[model samples]
Target: MSEQATTPQDLADDAVVLDVREQDEWDAGHAPGAVHIPLAEVPARIDELPDAEPLPVICRSGGRSGRAVQWLSAQGYDVVNVEGGMKAWEQGGKSVVSTGDKAPEVL
Candidate 1:
């Protein structure tokens, strides 16, 4: 991983994570308070990203988030790709939440 990538273990306690996974993936499971904006929607959702803080971007694995970080960085956003994304998050024993009443699991 580059300096722009961070493992779930390195995530900050209070930082808000920006989830760039698709809607179905998001509906299955995600970190509580994570912002849901699919990779395809980022161009239109740039206004929603954190402006003053370093945003942590995640996806199913690291692939999509890595792409997002590259684009977001080019636009001057201080962003970091979550190295292992949500899969690592769940495996690291971090909390996960789901839409509706479903149990949260990384799909």
Candidate 2:
């Protein structure tokens, strides 16, 4: 099934929000309950994602997530690029979880 792109608010109750940012960035702050799988590792880690439905991909900015969407879509996975990424989520007033530590290294 084709999965259309969605906003944080449009995410289904059971949908998984995949954060493609590196570990440190994730630890510093991220969408609550987001799953971290660095961009470079996504191809190998694809199995870690849920297969029941499409997943929403997110990044610090929209760029990485959009790239991920392209790759995943080409791979036949049901995925959506979250436009504007975390920036959009923050602007939408969504809650972010912070680890109170140093920021993560951007890969």
Candidate 3:
């Protein structure tokens, strides 16, 4: 939403980062502080989404997140797909964190 290079810390006060990757992918690595809601769970987990604007959505790559953005947009949420997703972030030198004891890595 703000910029394609968005990290958790880079988001504005009213903005939030959503990682729509699966459990395994998320456990592999993700942006620290990002709200995770796997793409498949988005509909049932609608209430879990933060009431924030400019929701920055991401996945392993741009495909899933792009679909999420399209669906969320139709539902009246302000969302944008993070182009290239986590791969772009990792390549861009943005920080990543793991859900387990292992080091962070894009999966």
Candidate that scores best on TM-score: 1
Kindly report which residue stretches of model 1 are placed more than 4 angstroms away from their true locations once superposed: none
What's the CA RMSD for each of the models? 1.3, 3.9, 3.5
Give the winner by TM-score: 1 or 3: 1
Residue-wise C-alpha lDDT for candidate 2, range 32-69, written one tens digit per residue:
66788999999999889755457788898778888998
Query: The CA-based lDDT of model 3 is what?
Result: 0.80
The Cα RMSD in angstroms, rounded to one decimal, for candidate 2 relative to the true structure is 3.9
Worst 10 residues of 1 by lDDT: 6-15
Taking the tens digit of each residue's C-alpha lDDT, what string does model 1 give over 1-107? 78788888887544589999999999999988699889999999888875536888999889999999999999988889998889999898888889989888898
Candidate 3 ranges with C-alpha deviation above 4 Å: 1-15
lDDT (10s digit) by residue, model 3, range 1-107:
43433443355433457889999999999887589999999999989996657778989878898889889989998887777788887887777888879989999
* Model 2: lDDT of residue 2: 33
Worst 10 residues of 3 by lDDT: 1-10
State how far residue 33 of model 1 sits from its true place (Å). 2.3
